[model samples]
Target: MAVLGLQVVFSLVMFTFLHKLAPYFSVGRWLLSKRLSRYLHPTNDELKQLSSGNQPGKTTGQTSKAKRRAEQRRNAASAQADKSESFTVPRNLPIQLDQALVEDIDLVPLQFYSEYTWLMDFSLCSLVIYVLTEIYFIITPHRLEFNLSILWCLLAVAFCVRVLASQAWIYLRTQEGGERILLVTFTFFFLVFAMGVLIVGDNVIEFGIEEGYKNFSTSATKFLEQQGMTSHGPVSFLTFKISLAFFGMLVGTLLTFPGLRLAKLHVDTLKYSQDRKITQLLLQINYLLPLLLILLWVKPVGRDLLCGKTFSKVKPVFYEDQFEGFRLLLVVVMCGLRILLMPKFMQAHLNLAHEKIESIKKESGRITNIELQKTIARVFFYLCVVAIQYVAPVLLILFLTFLLKTLGGLSWVSLFGETAVSFFTPTSKPGMKLPKLGGENSTLGTIMDSAAEFTSTLGDIRGIFTPVWYRGILNFFLWWVLTVWFSSTSLGVMYYSQNL
Candidate 1:
């Protein structure tokens, strides 16, 4: 009560002082005029009448009508001014900063940059790549552990230096632009954003790793141990592989949305005509190359850490699963070249894009849709050939899925100079049997036929990857569902692992 009374007394004293000082302070008088004018504003006629000091008999209705018309005119002018303001985001902001970094750079393919700029790019890419490696540790049956090894110390020191380099680069760049105050602010905010994103990823990955460890340590691996079939490699490899595939795709999808958003901004904002291929290639190098390297380097055992059970065992064993985590990671990433790249194909739709998607799109009459399709196909084929290391044929299914999505039902078959089989029904109510390729009794041809039928049902990867046909936000939500499902499974595994 005493504090409340003192507050009221302080407020009264301040109000009295402000009232007395209104005439002396320009700011105070302006504020007072604003507050008082709201209820006292007069129309032109009233102002003229006041100036003339004339009293002409007029109905209250006439004065009210004049006031209404004046208010309407003022409101219309305000709305017109508001409409003229552009919706463009400020340049060099954390969310939009990557645009400025590339806007002024040239697109000469394979050209190198200056030492400091290269150093800056390296540092920025390292932060992103480390985030990816951290993710691999979580879902690949390996929990990150600090080691006393000297190599570990070197790597740790390098990472610390990288962080400092990113800060210095931002500061120096802002300094060059003559925004001295923005140097500290941009560096600080961007660091916070980077750390926040990595931390969220870490928590998600850590939770899954910890839970999976619990699950197999007790019941699943325990059951296999009783049967004397306990090999964490294959024992929990399937679960781990599925989790990695889902998580990798999930991360890839998330990266695509923001990646394309930034790329779209570049397409929209840059004053010069950009070389589409080189621009996109540079983007992939800066934002995506590290993640790709981490995915490719991942092996069930040799490259990655041991399983939770294996790591926690009395003596740890280091052997990888045959075609589990790494292979799936490869496929999940490989199929997403288009998925990770919508802004590259941002159409020339004027309503959706405030600026042209790319001036290059309009520059050439020879850059046909067929050429675009072929370009996509050529890259995908090479990527598959490189990443599909073991049981390399498994990627065939993923590739087939991609084809089905991009090319309509029978159109893909036509590309190979082959015909698609349709309704192979028997004349007399008996169904047609798939014939053997090797021999009458051989199972391989029938298995091939069955696989084809199954793959046909997997639906469209093309429709989802294409910017014109895709719903990016919806695709992201589906990946989120996968995260939730697998995350829950890990928790269940942990719960039972504890009890058993």
Candidate 2:
């Protein structure tokens, strides 16, 4: 539990720091360009002027003062004309396109091919196999589990088809319009979803069970034993399914921070001409603080505390009571810190966004139909990705909570309490009292116990779907949304004099 807490804290801190550092990183690139300019080749015009012995900054010592002044004025006028035409005269501009830049751009296509194109081919092959196998099963429909297996096969095929279609669309539209950030974001999401389906599909195929559905009792027994925790009741497959959905959603949500940040940076780069160092710094700081806070809260107190056997042992009661208090306190402190920093962060984001919008408006001059369509498409895509990243996990968690209640007779409050305890408690205690089962509880308990035992015996079966690190992104999103909503409402009422 302590390790988990520390991990979470570390991730949050890293994210915060990255966000704050983005602008400075951008500035660093600009600085590097400026410093390297001296090494760049002279432009054609510059070379011509130098070869012709017509240096703008040079004046012969014998030349009359008035003539020199007139020459300077002429040069100034020419420079102004060049500026009006948006022409820049680089003293040491590159004679040829930088090989590194060419490589960077070319690598994007190679990456696209490797990540999406290759995946598409693999999915297509899988779909073909699935279809052929399903048809064979249909022809020999004498089996009891035929229908279930067929459904599972169909689902597998459908997912593969969807993957293929999405990849094709991305490829087709890649040239028409798409930011690097947007493409990368979608690609990552697609890969995550594809990996999940593949994992689940492999499990189903191996078990020869339709959709890999295990009996409730069997699954419950297996899960408890796997956790090395004594089960007083059965576990439900439905409950397990719900948990998996929540887990996926949480993973997706955690992934969104990087995607959103990338999208924002892309948008900003397109929209703003000025540097955004401060804005980036604020974002990085925001990401870093949460992680640091988690680390601070989780790190062992001292050598004495580390050596203490009593402190090292996991106690459920300690997690449920003491850990809860500790978490609550930590949350309060973090929230307070965020609130204090909110004004600065909001200012930076808004200012950068506003500047970008203004720049876009100026650049467009008159928005054409094609430009408008591109803008709308980009907006839609950004919204879709953001919404999926933020809302999916929350919905998944809620769905899991609901399913667990219905199928396992698990109380939502008690389950959360258990989760809290499991997360915080140091591992040492032998046995703890399980939460009481509610409506239709005994039957479910039996099913869960049997399932748990079966799963324990087959270690490979349990390993198929478990995630290494569980990120509670949904929980964070829920809190953030609630905070924003309340804040907005309070501000609205205060300004409108509604309370008065």
What C-alpha lDDT do the candidate models reach, one value each?
0.31, 0.35
After superposition, the stretches of candidate 1 with alpha carbons farther than 4 Å from their true spots are 1-173, 176-183, 190-500
lDDT, candidate 2, 44-88, per-residue tens: 344346435565343457979776445423322333444333222
Model 2 misplaced regions, further than 4 Å: 1-176, 179-259, 262-285, 292-321, 332-346, 357-500
Model 1, span 1-500: residue lDDT tens: 34233323433543454456533443211211222111111223332343355543433445576654454233223334444332221121111000101112111111121222332233223323333433332333322222112122234334333433443444456635644453344334433433332234323332233333343344444445655774553335445445444544433322222232333323332222255666556544433432443332233322344333425553423223322233334434543443233223222111121122232234434333223222322322222111111111112223322322222111122222222211211123343465657654569866787786665433222222233212222222223323322233233334434543
Q: Which candidate number has the best TM-score?
A: 2
Model 2 clash tally? 40
